[model samples]
Target chain A: MALKPYIVNTGIITAIGNNTQQCKDALLSGKNNIGKPTHLKTHWESEIPVAEIKLSNKALADMAGVNEEWPRTALLSAVAVKEAWLPYAEIATGLRTGFFSANTVGGMDLTEGVYREFKETGTVSNISSVINHECGAITELVAKHFKIEDFVTTISTACSSSANSIMMAAQMIEAGMLDIAIAGGADSLSKFTLNGFNTLMILDRQSCQPFDNNRRGLNLGEGAGYVVLMNDKAMAQCNATAICTVSGYANANDAYHQTASSPDGIGNKLAMTQAISKAGIQPSDISYINLHGTGTANNDSSEGKAIEGVFSGNVPMASSTKSFTGHTLGASGGVEAVFSAIAIRDGVVFPNMRWETQMEDVNWKPVTELQTGIAIDHVLSNSFGFGGNCSSLVFSKS
Target chain B: MDIYIKGTGIISAAGDNSEGTFLHEPPTYDTDKLLSKEPNYTAYIQPMQLRRMSKAVRMGIGASRMAMQQAGVEKPDAMSLGTAMGCLQDTEHFLAKMVTQEEQMLTPTSFIQSTHNTVGGQIALLAGCYGHNLTYVHRGHSFEHAMINAQLYLNDHPTHNILVGGIDELTDSSLQVMKATGVYRKANSTEQILNTNEPGSLAGEGATFFVVDKNPSEGSLHIKGIGISTPEDTAAAAAQLDKFMQQQGLSNTDIDLVMSGWNGNSSGKEFYDNINERFSASSIAGFKHLSGEYATASAFGLGMTMEIVKHGAVPAHMLLNGKQPKALKNILLINSYGHYLSIWHITA
Candidate 1:
């Protein structure tokens, strides 16, 4: 028998708030956290506006209750994982649990300083600074900090990373390889990633406006998000209440370009359609959508076209919460997944903050105001990445 | 569902092809860098397309093409790739240019290719495969995660042919940084590498791909099981290995040969020694003496093990104990990357 995976708990830390409930409250209150940078020290700090988490590295470490000096990515991951794992604290000890995290720019935020110092002084003062430089190193640190010693690993596929992590956990649970899986991703603001996005000319000077007529580019942000998924047997044994069921998920390659999506969004269309089929549902069954809206010219246009192709003329209510928490790169999928679960659980549609006009190419409009008392049974979330990696996930109410 | 390795391709310090059973001569190197021997990539990729690809992408596409051609698969239905440090050369290129030029006048090529999934995406694009595409970037378990994902994909989509691979490259800046971190030793030759009890190990890079499917073709090797864990000590690691073998219904004595990952480093010597003692009844072989050490070095080890099982023979230089095994029907391959241990069960 194939096991159905359910989201029993969730944790998230973004520019808007620090936990799932806080994020939901921020969404309900029409609070946007995108603003000029104050924490990240970069050359463009005064010029560009980003949705940065309003905390220093020291503050984050203190909040995470870690005495050792750690990178911002690992610190954020520890904070989110702790909140997500709180409910299953006792039962997880003897269960076949796994931790699957997605991360990019792992410790680059710290290593950049070390590299610069080495260039100037020709010597590294502390080896610990570069020890967590690898993408998996962040996951390893977070896992060890949380005392999660089973099946810990990391995934990196650009922005779609954590979506793939959740999908992989679902598959593993269905195959009986794991009873419960904690899946999410973390990425912190680093000059390497900031300059990388700036070189592509995709960093907006102003706050981003996703799916809008005059949308220019994205605002790079940093944070973490995670969800705890359990099989039916594990759920029963733990006597936990599920927030939603991870009904279906699919991944497809665009095969178009290295960084650009196709004009037709073929990969996006295929992923959404395949995921819908896997869930055994019709397009009309989808009640809401958490768009992968980075507000970049290419992403909005391509994802809008893909949305039109998937839902046809009558599209479901959709919004991009990235307006509240800028494009978080690798952590965007996990952030949006948590938002989708909240939308399903609370029956509310998050507003696409700062939207004025519809896109020129696609004929659709996002929900611009917080919608309450709506019936949201099934939610579809999309996360696309560089190299044309596209993924879609369907979360249904439990 | 049963997964079969239809074909394999590898580019390592040994050579570019996967037809041979032995490393004729150990690759000689004075420095810590053990770069892969380049093949004629023009045979697989066009010059126009090759101009934009980095070393990792070129090697990955070339290896996938060779494996697909040998497996009689024109286009695989899916692809899953693994890498610990992806496209390091391009990443360093972009990062240096960004810093040196003050983040001005930059092309998107380097930044785009620097992503970890670029290699797998390139393989899918070249093969025109729009099916499932995934990339795993776990540290030492990267290849193992890719293999496990391949198995799940085959189980879910039984008719789909999958291309699974692990690719990593060594660059100058990365080498400098790693050497500073004391990950690369000053040892030179294979003999010195084995004799060294230093804290650091040698560095190597390679790209290896396999065409996997549910249908068993002629001369295809059957994959028995794959298990990965991160235990605190060698005793726990040995217990994990035992549990994995027992899950596959095989005892330690049922193994004809044992392939271990022992890179002349004192960091993981105890773990390897424990494995050596556990598989005492079987012929023991080591590969890191030839392949050097890297996060995905075990991928190259697994490829070589498959070749050995296919030929039913073990090279004299690889054996640490006996001359020959009665038969290479069942072989156990184990690798310990720091605290992580990966076990693979393969049979002819």
Candidate 2:
């Protein structure tokens, strides 16, 4: 609580952009990365919409400078991690380096292919293909790629997974555990997850309209995001310029249901309120909020009520970047955290994309257009997920 | 900061070690694959809810319940868990259906239960605990990270009682995959596993949970240090162990017992020989012969060591070198899974 972890740099890739600057550029122009995706090969690709990055495994591997045989999830993670590690790599040798990554599906894209073939013919041809099938295996693959062996771990608490990862890295830093931590998460679109979300019947055929009264459901997206965190020692050694200081973060469980939030967003409220308290600030001190508005009926409604419960008056400029990138699932927290960092760095408010009607539960209206040139000191980022996992992070201007 | 292990619960090939129940003689698996000696789910979970859970979730719930009951903790301040491979049954179910049905007319039950954090979520939901919760899945380091997180929580909130555990389950599909990789073999006998000069080890799975209290009124069990290392070569494992010992201000002679992961296989023989050379004076032992080999089997080793400290006797079958130490004090556990090594120092 006393030591503020510094976020020195960030990197991200989504349907709208491939890097942090590119994402900022896309947000300013109000680009919609959601629609019928071209990369994902699914039976519902024609009927259901997604936000897949327009690239093949071969292309992503080439860009990542790794083996093409790796999982798409690992490839995405390597690309963003490489970008995040570039500046930090200078002084990483003198410090204890760590890599904490997150993902939901692991190497399911590869596992399903091999498993399907085995199921069809009852013969196995290369068991090595699915060797990275575990979530941690994917983390190790990318960790090995970066040669970050001082410390390594993976978190998988669903959509809130990477927020918790970022939070964990900061805690480790505050506890004087590691000097440098490259933390975030990655997930690539796969038939396994596509059908899983489809089975839940939460896919919106059209581009998602988050925080809108007529919002049906979410459009699943795929990508990776990462942030380099450093304590004072590493910062001094690296001569790093702080992008932002992590003021506070907290993780809480909804405990209401496995797949759904408590109708009032109890976990969301606790996470936000606790983080604000830990940051030693008032609710009104927040400049903007990057909502976890996944365009789902339950998520937006629950998250909105929780926001109202915490704040007394008019809320600050807030929007859901998911409207532009769609719901990136496991990668959303890191993806949105990068968005939040730049939002404070440049004082920009990304749009909520399309909001025709407001939900009756809350009075605040999401920003409908990109607004820049405003001073932002504090930004709140939300990431809620299945399995009752909910987390929030607060970053203050350094 | 010193933390005490107030209570422990485990459901593994060893036994259902709940309150009023503890493993005295570990059950020997006649088959190569070792499954947990599961308790009646009705004792910990409702019948209706039990049907919905996969075996991993059920074992997690049952073990956590046993730990909470023994510690008298209705709700903990936080929970952190480790599972190398999570919810395999549900993951495979969802994958098989998606592949066979071509993503049509599937129910959400398996998909909903397939999440890695389902056990933690279910436990938190049942306990009505709204505190810090986390899950680690970094192969061998998974359980160690969970332990590290628990220590961090206690460092911040010294009065807090945290629940921490490691869990992994084996499914037929997963076993098939492991078999194809040539590290899995069927059993001849539990005794034969320890002496095997073969290429593979027995497959096993289990759950182990502990109630870690920063301010326990009475306890002897303590965690001195936990460290993880990725050795570039076979010889680097011992070098990392020496560095960790120096970090903890300890010497090889200070350790009275060494519980090493000597899973019976040619691939693991070098590591076993390394452990033997490092701790020649200490009472050397292995648990994979009793608990079998898994990513988080070190959790089982920790639980077994706790039982030995409480009872003040090491089971004859547990000691590989066949020499029981006259006194038990500092016990070290080193587990190797894949390319990772988890080293833990438990003090009694």
Candidate 3:
């Protein structure tokens, strides 16, 4: 048998909750955290609702046991990675490990404050505030925090960033470059990203209704999610228990627009088809799909059509969890990957929150109710991002 | 899996894609930041695409196109890229607007272009080929990591050509911020880059793309090995280098030349000193003196190494110690930035 990369552990903190169990419970309860922002100080606070985690930077720092000066993104990453790493701490040491973090607005939440001060005052008060301004700073911070010095890198492919990170880690491990890999992404709410999405008219005013005909746009959310991956040898050597196998993954570009998917959904179709094929399984084998439904009209119709094209109207059960957690951008892939793994591990299909009507242009409607007792042998998750970057992954029960 | 450097495209302070133009008369920068010598981007990018692309994206696209053209390949099976700062020009533009405008009435152009993967995404979009797309953003190891990914991908699919590259651009605000942090030398020329004896090295930016394939194209060089490590100190770094060489079945005498990223700075002196002492049997050379210093300078160094490997000769200006090698068979491009070390062994 081919060497299979398994998800040995997972960690997540989102608007829904701080751990996998809490988030899973909330998903089944059909509860959402999307609401008016209490912290992110943007002018559109009154106009747009976000799924902001109800915690300050100081509070998160305290939770992560770090100084409050660390960027919220890094702090959130630390919290999530700590949870994921604790179980494998003994085996992780002295192993050829690699950490691949996915993030877009890295450290911007902190740098923007200092930058605004400098723009007005003509000098930054403390240069250290902007030290972590780049995207790799969070990865560096998290890697150092865990003392993981084997291999580390950051990926920033917009919404698909973390999914690609997960894919890269599996590829590296399969190539014998790393024995174990920690793959995921983190992003914190910031005026930069919020306003950026707002400018594109993609920020919904209320809770996002993904896959619904009346869906307007996405509700920007923030958090971090990670998974520990190990091959068979590493698993046996470390005595780590497998959560689920990272069966297959593929990344493709739409080549359509910078921020929009193609009308034909060619890239989305290719990603799903290729991922299913690489899993050495047929499309019918995908038990559930965590759709990249950001509640936008373009995304729903395009992705819906792509599913139709690839699955041939016999599409399996699917839902867009973004309705519950909001669109987390770079971290969305990691968050949804965790959900997919859990779906395969626990045999549950999480619901697509706040869906009423299906689109007229599409042939299938997403699962709107909490599903249980489903034999979810394989779960396919899709994460499409800006610049036409799209990725899909298959998580199978070990 | 045997990986070959089928083609190369580079845009830096040295010049555009041609090695002749870059090696003959390299541009000298008196400013703290050495900017790239741009080509007519309209040749590679259309107007609609050009309107939204940042300088980094444009450079990345231009270099990738030239590389694909040189390799005579219409569509690569995959595209991988690395950028340490990643669209800094657009990032600063969007951040400045977000601050000045108080996050209101901002345009989405800069925001869409600010992502680190914009270049890789754009390259795929331009080519309409997206097999496995990835972008690495680890400080000094960005390009090295991307190359590593390319090798792994080739190992899986042995009959695929991959476009791999590194790109980063310098912006005014970014330079100013670095200046405030004391990361760039204020007054330095390209000639003084090696002997500045300064506290900080001059900042520079460019993009270099390569077409890597399993089958060796005509006149292409083979990549024998690649390794990247973040060591605690000089001792750990030396051990890692030794292990890397041993894994490749190579010794000091087997390497004909050693290209070191010896940027003129006191911070990197210890690492350079260790390299100079360790590689006494090889012809030591330097390239940051001509291309300046940047996070992905190793990409430029790779381009330079390929040129030397193809010609079997090394230019006198790049020689740091020992005469030019009698016959260039294998060249090791070694780059160290603080605690990070990247090694690439190129053989013809």
Candidate 1 residues lying further than 4 Å off, grouped into runs, are A120-122, B18-22
Docking class of 3: medium
lDDT (10s digit) by residue, model 3, range B1-348? 368998888888777765354575545567777888888888888988788778899899998888888788888899888888998888889988888777767898888888888888788888888578888888888888888888887877888889999898987777777777777778687677887567777888889999998887668989878888888777788898899898888888888889898898887777787888777878898988766677888898898887677666777778888568856777788887556688888888
Tell me the DockQ of each model, to 2 decimals. Answer: 0.73, 0.82, 0.74
lDDT of residue A270 for candidate 3: 88
TM-score against truth, every candidate: 0.97, 0.98, 0.97
Looking at model 2, residue B260 earns an lDDT score of: 80
Cα lDDT, all candidates: 0.85, 0.86, 0.85
Q: Give a tens-digit lDDT track for model 1, residues B24-140.
A: 554555666677887888889999999888889898888788788778889999988899998888887887776677666777678888888989888877777888998888889
Q: Which ten residues in a row have the lowest lDDT in candidate 1 chain A?
A: A114-123
Tens digit of per-residue lDDT, candidate 3, span A289-371: 99999999899889999999999989999999999889888899999999998898888899888889879999899998888
lDDT, candidate 3, residue A111? 87
The order by descending lDDT is 2, 3, 1
Root-mean-square deviation of Cα positions for candidate 3 versus the true structure, in angstroms: 1.6
Cα lDDT of model 2 by residue, A223-312, tens digit: 999999998888888888898988888888889999999999999999999988878899899999999999999999999989988886
Model 3 chain B: ten consecutive residues of lowest lDDT: B18-27
